[model samples]
Target: MQRLLPQHVRAATFDRRRWRGLDPEQVYAYLDRLADELERLTRDLCTANTEGERIRQALRQWQSRHTDCRHTQVAPNSRWHR
Candidate 1:
């Protein structure tokens, strides 16, 4: 099943009952609040994903640049250590 999104909440409709129906204004207000919150959370999630990707890329680059150095070992009797 597809997950409900902010747009879905905003576009939701309900049938009205002539005898005992819910107040349309109240329903709309609640939907608006829910949609706004969903929108904010979605935005935050996107930003977090972008930042995570950036960090991962940086880490990969750093590892690539340092992999060789990390594998190199220093000798105790090297010329520079004399």
Candidate 2:
């Protein structure tokens, strides 16, 4: 599902009732804070995703380079085999 962007939150409009309606100032202030948090979270998520892809690529390259050794057996006398 698509997520809401900071602009969406800032541009949101709510219907006001004749009586007992929500305070527009409070709603706008809260929306502003929510938008700010969403923007920060979006940035953080992007950074994390990019870093994760980098790590995945590095892991794939390392695995390809080590593919031959993956099937090799070590002697019983080898410290690593022990």
TM-score winner: 1
Clashes of each: 0, 0
Tell me the deviation in Å of residue 79 in model 1: 14
lDDT for every model? 0.94, 0.95
Q: Model 2 clash pairs? A: none
Candidate 2 wrong stretches, greater than 4 Å: 16-19
Error of 1 at 73 (Å): 1.9
| Cα shift from native, residue 19, model 1 (Å) | 1.6
- Model 1, span 1-82: residue lDDT tens: 9887999999999898888989999999999999999999999999999999999999999999999987887798997655
Which stretch of 10 consecutive residues in model 1 shows the poorest summed lDDT?
Answer: 73-82
Alpha carbon deviation, residue 14, candidate 1 (Å): 0.6
